[model samples]
Target: MKLSPTYRMPLKRRREGKTNYKKRLALLKSGKPRLVVRKSLRYIRAQIVEFDPKGDKTIVGVLSKELKKYGWNYSFKNLPAAYLTGLLVGKKALERGIKEAVLDIGLHRATKGAKVFVVAKGAIDAGLKVPLGEGILPSEERIRGEHIANYLEKFKNIKEDFEKIKQKILGEMNG
Candidate 1:
């Protein structure tokens, strides 16, 4: 008998059951806070949540979209933007007294060379330890390449002197 194609396909359901289960178990086991990351096509957000089964509480949360008003252009879908988001979130968490956290990546698989990893690196650079080394990618090469190759094609002749701006961003990433 032939089976339907949908039968073999993985349904879009709460795959987080396993990851969340492991996260809660780890949180309970280690008694450490959770640093959760959620990403989208346009933006990425992070939160440091303290799991208290007995109470309705989210310890602290940082959304990158809020950083736009501070002049963070999130339209650039590259390592630099991802890193900045991570840095902003990490700094906010640190300001709220979150020194360390277990990186709970939710349902997303932790790939080695991926945008999410870039964000993790940014967060790490901003001082949140995630069992990873200093997370700053050489912004000069990556950002410059992305701007000239990806961004320039769509928005021609932007007024923001690309080279100088790239150098400045690279400096910020490095520093």
Candidate 2:
């Protein structure tokens, strides 16, 4: 008897559980700390979580919305924005005495050159170690500066896209 296409795959493979559970288990076993990233259309967030499996505990958290006061308005959706978010989270973590952590990329595939990697780079730049590759080393102002630099570099390609976003933000600010 032949099984259906979906059934041919194991339960874990059929669902997204395999990768997610693997990441969670790895984070739990590493015993170091977990830097988890979650993103959305308007904002991005990162947190340092300690898995207790029996209690409520969150080491630290940083939200992009909160960084807007520092001039990080969400008018851009590029590597630079991601970099800024990472920088903020890393800086906050460092202030809380978190120097090292394990990246828990839940439900997300680990791609070499991706936005998540770029965020990790920003965190590394801010002095957080992730034991995966060479870390990024950045100063406190690195995020804002790098965001500007990246925007300038890709001005030609992203000008049109960012212009619309900028206009919308400006309108909101004015109204």
Candidate 3:
């Protein structure tokens, strides 16, 4: 009896559920840098990456934890933190001469007004051109940490802190 030929195995990242080749191929086809946003339980990270024949090269990268340098003292995985990280990465990318990028939310669901989109909105606010549809961003109030402020008494100062950190990032970017 003839047996079928040995089946090929998927790439390690694909088998481990870390990479999606189809989506990645589409993003690469756009011929723009990728704004890669990834989140964990306690942190968020944003990077501007360019495709290379040998491997991907990161143009700029920022972690939510880096917000501490800008005086952010809240949860690093929250919406506001994601935005700040995005903004930071965006500004850094701009400084590196990258003006636009395509969003690459790997394996993340495309939820409207979600943290990922909030990051995209922040990048946009930082003057990075990323193509997004209408109404994809969270409302301004949410991005400002007003929701957290309204949810708890101790967070009453979150909005003020958010504004301060935002200004600091922008100020440092310009100066």
Winner by TM-score: 3
53-83: candidate 1 lDDT, tens digit per residue: 7942567665656645545453545555666
lDDT of each: 0.60, 0.63, 0.91
Candidate 1, 62: how far from true, in Å? Answer: 2.2
C-alpha lDDT (0 to 100) for residue 171 of candidate 3: 90
After TM-score superposition, the amount by which residue 41's alpha carbon in candidate 3 deviates from its true location, in angstroms, is 0.8
Clash counts per candidate, in order, are 0, 4, 0
Report per-prediction Cα RMSD to one decimal: 7.5, 8.9, 1.5
lDDT by residue (tens digit), candidate 3, 1-175: 8587678889999999999999999999999999999989999989999999999998898889999988898999998998888889888988999999999999999988888888888898898999998677778898999999999999999999998999999898899
| Tens-digit per-residue lDDT, 1-175, candidate 2 | 7566644555665375545555567678888888887767876677888878695267888766664555544443456566656666777778788899887766666665455665677677677887665443334333334445555674443434434433443344345
lDDT of 1 at 113: 48
